[model samples]
Target chain A: MKLLEDRIKKDGQVLPGDVLKVDNFLNHQVDPDLMFAMGEEFARLFQDEKITKVLTVESSGIAPAILTGLQLHVPVVFARKHKSLTLVNDLYTSTVYSYTKKVSNEISISKRFLDADDRVLIIDDFLANGQAVMGLIDICEQAQAKIEGVGIVIEKTFQRGHELIAEHGIRLESLAKIAALEDGKVVFEKQNN
Target chain B: MKLLEDRIKKDGQVLPGDVLKVDNFLNHQVDPDLMFAMGEEFARLFQDEKITKVLTVESSGIAPAILTGLQLHVPVVFARKHKSLTLVNDLYTSTVYSYTKKVSNEISISKRFLDADDRVLIIDDFLANGQAVMGLIDICEQAQAKIEGVGIVIEKTFQRGHELIAEHGIRLESLAKIAALEDGKVVFEKQNN
Candidate 1:
């Protein structure tokens, strides 16, 4: 976690609209060693949960989620934002609004992947408005899957994401918690949970 | 590679439009164990390449790419299909046509990710017309990166994907090569490359 926090402060860029760009090492251009460390930390934290599946959204979340799945020795089921050619029907679907993209997308997971027997741990690159994680949770609920908390690489503490996830009574863990991104600097929250 | 082929034969579905749906284990619902197996196989195949980076497109390719990066002790950079909020304009961009999606999408990588110093090995979930891989190669070309080779999970041999990639003089390795999908059964080519 310290490694992630330090790397974020050193390389993260702040844009208008509260955008903290960690693309240099995080989402777009992934550092696999760093990603493995993050995943190991997440797996260590949630080792007792007996996580059956690691769930995430498409695109950005795939890297960390895959590593986590590898660490946890579980299958990963990424909710597709669009109707992929191979994805079948009878899916657990949820609509999520993307704060960055400014467009709502339908996130769906196959019914065959997640079911009542699944204990799902949701993982993602960043948690800001909590919309994406919430959508994943909604799909799990629809499938009667047990929730096994959420793991995030970076958390924007200034946003309402943490509070929203807290309301669901799900345990949330973020590697790096950013207090703010001001003056092109990343401020970390003193206490990370 | 045999593990991948075995799994594909058992779980992969043959859909219309030359679609081979291995979503059960390959793309949507990823088997990390199997994915790691594929990565190890890829690492074994390209061991002498001294790959500096493993590259792929987002959404599905991250799983294998991450595992391959882990095995190779390298970084993984995924080209974004959409312009993400944090991605900058100093990018190597290329347009790709998706035969399955019936839409054209622009794939891009930040110039910071790929460079002439990198020996990139492009990995993907499927290979059909090779447009996606070619687009990635184009982006790498723009970056002046040295391409090590291309690794694919499944290749529809009935399509021209192999021919197009061969024209680039880049080595191609596909885990499973499908000869045809007739009568709702999947047929694989006699030889794999």
Candidate 2:
């Protein structure tokens, strides 16, 4: 977690409208070595939980999800944004409003992948207003799967995402939580440990 | 490679209209152990090349790309399908036509991630008509980066993807090359190893 916070401090760009650009190492361009380290951290945090599947949204979350799955030796299921031709008719669908893209899109996972017997861990790159994470939680709820925990790479603590997940009584762990971004500087939340 | 080929044979579904769906392990739901094996195989295949980065399209390709990056100890840059507020203005963009979706979309990589000095290895889930690969190739061309090779999980030998990539004079390595998927059965091409 310290390594991730350091990386974000060194390379992250803070822009207007609460935008933190980590393309150099997190989202668009990924640092695999650091990603694997983060995966190990997630595995350590959720070692007690019975996580059967790692669920995430497409594009940004896939890297961290893959790394976490590798560390846990579990399977990862990414919800596709666009409906492909091969997607089965039976699916758990949820609508997510993207504040970045300014569009509402439907996210879905095939019913064959999730069921009541599964314990799921949801992972994502950024947790802003918690819309995307809520959508993933919605899908899991529909499938009757047990929510083990949620792992995030970078979280905006000033936003309502952390509170929303906590309101559901789910354990949420984030590597780097940004308290504020003032004058192109990232202010991280002080670690209690 | 044998493991990958075996997975394809067992879990891969050959639908009507030349569509082979391996979502069970490759795309929608990813098996991290198998993904790690494929990454090791890719590292072996491109051992001679000095790969500075791993490039791929988003959604389906990010898992393998991240695993391959871990093996190579390099950064993985995934081209995003849509532009978001976090993305910078400077980018390398290419248009790709999806045969399955029956539409064309733009894939773009941030200019900050790729440079002329970087040697990239492109990774993907499947290579059918080579449209997505071609799009990545175009981005590499625009950035003036060196493309060491293209690593594909499954290559449909009956399709023209291999021929197109071959024509480009880039080294193409596919773990499993299917000669045909006729009558819902996968026929693999014998490797020349």
Candidate 3:
């Protein structure tokens, strides 16, 4: 977590609208070693929980989810944001509004992949307004799967994401939480004990 | 390679219209153990090459690319299909036509991620018509980076992907190459000694 926070400070760019750009190592251009380290941290954080599967959205979350799945020795089921021809008809679909893209898109996972017997750990790269997390949670609910916990690599603490996850009483662990972006500088939240 | 070929034969679904769906282990729902093995295989295949970086498109390719980067101890840079608010203006972009989705989308990699000094190894899930790989090669060209090779998990030999890749004069390694998909059965191409 310290390593992630340090890397964010070193390379992360702060844009207007509270956007933190971590393309150098986090999202667009991923550092696999750092990703694995983050995965290990998530594994340590959720070691007690009975996590049968790691759930995440496509694109950005796939790297961390795969790494987390490797560390936890669990399967990763990534929800596809765009509907592809390969996708089966039996699926649990949820629509999420992306603040970044300013478009509402449907994210879905096959019913065959998730079920009531599994304990799901939802993972994602950024947790801003919690719309993506909420969509995953909705899918889990539809599948009747148990929500083990949620693991986030970077979170905007100033946003309402943490509050919503807390409202659900789900254990949420974020490696780096940004408190504010003032004058193009990232101010991180004090480490939560 | 045998392990991967076996996996393809076992779990891979041969759908109508030459589609081999291995979403259970390769893409949608990823098996981390198998993914790690595939990554190790990719490392073995490209061990001789001077791979400065591993490149792939986002979503499906991120898992294998991460594993490949882990084995090679290099960073993985995934080209993002969808643009976010945080993406910088300077980028290496290319258009790719998806046969499955029937859509032409632009894939971009931040200019900061790649440079003329970098030797990139492109990794991906499936090599069908080679549109995606071509787009990746285009990005590498724009970045003035040398492409060492293209590593594909599954290659449909019946398709034109292999020929297109060969035309680029880059080494192509596919773990499992299917000669034909006859009557919902996978017929693997015989390995040449």
Candidate 4:
């Protein structure tokens, strides 16, 4: 977590509209070592949850989720933003609005991947308003799977994501929690530990 | 590679329109141990290429690419299929046609991540017509990066992907090379080794 916080301080760029760009090593371009470490941390945090599957959204969330799957020795399943013609099975669908992309897209996971018996661990890169994770949670509920925990890499705690997940009585853990970004500087909440 | 081929034979579904679904363990739901094996195999196959970065498109390609990056101890950068407002600078863009989605989309990589001095290895889930890899190759060309090789989890040799990549004079290695899928049964090409 310290490594991620330090890296964010060094290379993360803050644009207007609460955008924190970690493309140099987190979003577009990824640091595998750091990401793997973060994944291990997630596994450690949720070690007792008996997680059966790792779920995430496509694109940005795939990196940490795949690494976490490796650490937990579980299968990683990512919801697709686009519907493929090849995918003809009954899918559990949930709609998520992306403020960054300025579009609302339906995310889906094949029914074959999730079921009532699954203990799902949701993972993602960044948490803003928690809309994406909420969508994932919606899909999990549709499959009747137990939500073991949610792991996020960087969280904007100021965006009401923390309160939303807490209100749902779901456990949430993030590697780096950003309280605010002012004048290209990141503000961190006091370490909960 | 043997493990991958075996898994494909066991779990891969061959559908009409040349669709071979390994989503059970490769695409939609990823088996970490098997994916790690494939990544290690890729590292071994291209170990001498001195690859500085691993590149792929988003969604399905991220799993293997991230694993490959872990084994190689390099950064992994995925091209975004859609432009985001966060992306404000010039990008290395290429248009790729997806038979699965029935859409042609332009994939772009931020110019900040790739450079002329980098040696890039492109990784992907499957190769049917080589459109995705070709699009990645175009981006690499735009960045003026030297391409070490292309790594694919499964290659449908019955398609023109093999020939197209071969014609480009870039080294390509596929874990499972299917010669054909007749009568819902997969036929594998002779292993080059």
- Better structure of 3 and 4 per lDDT: 3
Q: Tell me the spans in candidate 1 whose CA falls farther than 4 Å from its real position.
A: A83-89, B83-89, B191-193
Cα lDDT of all candidates, in order? 0.88, 0.90, 0.91, 0.90
TM-score of each: 0.94, 0.96, 0.96, 0.96
1 versus 4: better lDDT goes to:
4
* Best candidate, DockQ: 2
**Poorest stretch of ten by lDDT in candidate 4 chain B:** B82-91
TM-score of 3: 0.96
Backbone clashes in each candidate structure, one number apiece?
A: 0, 0, 0, 0
List runs of model 3 lying over 4 Å from the truth: A83-89, B82-89
Candidate 4, residues A9-117, lDDT tens digits: the string is 9999999888898998988899999988998999999999999999999888988998899999999999888532345468888888878768788899999999999
The residue-level lDDT of candidate 2 at A158 comes to 97
Model 1 interface CAPRI class: medium
* Each model's fraction of native contacts: 0.90, 0.96, 0.96, 0.93
lDDT of 3 at A142: 95
The clash number for model 1 is: 0
Q: Which stretches of model 4 miss by more than 4 angstroms?
A: A83-89, B83-89
Residue A75 lDDT in candidate 3: 96
Candidate 1 lDDT over residue span B26-71, tens digit each: 8898888888889899999999999999999987888898889889
